[model samples]
Target: MRDPRMSAIGKGLRRRGRLMVQAVSPPRRVAPERRALNAVPAQRDPRQEAPGATPAPRAPRLVDSPVFVLSSVRSGSTLLRVLLNSHSRIRAPHEMHLRTVHVRFSRDFTADAMKELRLDRQELEHVLWDRILDLELRHSGKDVIVDKTPANTLIFRRLERCWPNARYLILLRHPGAVVTSLTDRRDNPDHAAICDEVLEYAEKLEEARQHLDHAHVITYEDLTADPERVTRGLCEYLGVPWESGMLDYGSHDHGRFRPKLGDWSSTIKSGRIQAARGADASLELPPRLLELAKAWGYPVD
Candidate 1:
């Protein structure tokens, strides 16, 4: 038999030689697809957090009970907003588009860093949203602030999550009228796409009206036909007394009426509480539109 010591030495030499060979070998080239995957960071959505992780404890908000007006585009939300802003204790600014604001974790360790502070990406965004509401309320010298972004209808659930104590105002308009306004205002409007958009908002609004016990529902027709009664009820719902001055919104400084920020059409800029144009009864409605309208108590005939 060979010497046991020589055998052990030979094994050690072989292991070291293999290591030296690998060290000198060129690094393996990463596949193109793998390199591309590493180049782009994963998108982090506020709605989606790591599964099975406990949500952070709720933090106190400076503006705890802010109001959000949920409605479809061209649904007279701007009219409602201006009317509310006219009140002494209420501040309703142009579309804040808070839903569009987002946060990104550029570094792999950043999310973990935030986790140490008892906050996730969603919680951080909630804090930012709360700060925005508080800042606007403070600046306006108003006790209550209302955000009348019509797009709020799309992400109402997220808003509710961010502000559990938040109040909601559901604004509705005849589906026909919304469709008409969209087609008229938008150049080369896609009729099918417009209907889809209206249906999407309507579905969400109906869901909200059904689900939220504290929500106040209003329609464009009722608001224009009897401003006093409707606004008095609104004041009651919002814990404020009726102010006759709210009707004469045209006389108040409601900031600049402009496009994208909110409604800026000549009709809205007129600052007059004009009667809502009656939707054509002859206009044939899609089955979904008819269904939603009937559900909301609008006449289908």
Candidate 2:
């Protein structure tokens, strides 16, 4: 039987059945008298209470055409990022993780106060993210900035809303490869959970590829196979001259490659673009994964 307490949280799952699994702490015990007080609804934010509240104006964006690389984890985005970072005019820094950085409305009037200044929680966070990108661009002495956070694929729509003029690089890999990579890297790997995660990312990647006006699709297999050709095309899309140094990214300083920030494996440290591994045919793929593999032009048979 489902716990009555988790009923509200269960509603958070999308109708399509995709869920980002998270650990939920057990409910805490409360005194009998306190339970009644806790039952009282919290005060609604002013914007929610106001009837017919029009859309609030937003602050101008700081970095208009910042590039975003949308890919699943272990999809070779770090490699793409470093190559771009090696370019003279592009700065691809460690994951800024703008989604994790947020603004909170503590007081009931906080929303009202921000609305007066043409700001809301989301817009304020966008401004802060833009400022961070601007700062990183200045530090790198580069004219263009790119964010290649793997998790960014989950929030591609929000990112597009934040920067309407943003450019996207939809990086793809074989679903079987993604599942194999994640399973090998995680400590206590759950194959079921891993496939679910890969599917979530694959769905979002496909959505972004279909929705975005300026999305450039690239595959991990092709990236390692012919980096010079792929990167030259990327440079052309980014409106920058193609520099041969980008092909030899090993010669550049692409910041620290550590856990959480990016792939810190020996393969990346070797300062070489190694060939991507083909899918593990021995491992059976889920139906959805098989579909995506075929959709992305990979042989699933």
TM-score for each model: 0.83, 0.83
After superposition on all CA atoms, how large is the RMSD of candidate 2?
Answer: 11.1
Best by lDDT: 1
31: Cα error in model 1, Å:
38
Q: Which tens-of-lDDT digit does each residue in 1-301 have in candidate 2?
A: 9897688677655533553333434556753422422343333455644667664565787788999999988899999999999999999998877777766688878887888787776687789999999999888888999999888888898888888899999999999999889877777777787788789889988888878867889999999999999998999899999999998889999878887788889998888999998766777778988988898898868
The TM-score of predicted model 1 comes to: 0.83
Pairs in clash, predicted candidate 1: none
Give the per-residue lDDT digits (tens) of candidate 1, residues 1-301. Answer: 8999999999999999999888774655643312321233346854346578788777788888999999988889999998999999999998997866667887788877887888888888889899999999889989999999887787899889889999999999999888888777776677786787788888999999998989999999899999999999899999999999999899888889876778888987887899998665655668989899999888887
Once fitted onto the true fold, the runs of candidate 2 whose alpha carbons sit more than 4 angstroms away are 1-54
Poorly placed runs, candidate 1 (over 4 Å) = 1-48
Worst 10 residues of 1 by lDDT: 32-41
- How far residue 57's Cα lies from its native spot in candidate 1, in Å, is 1.9
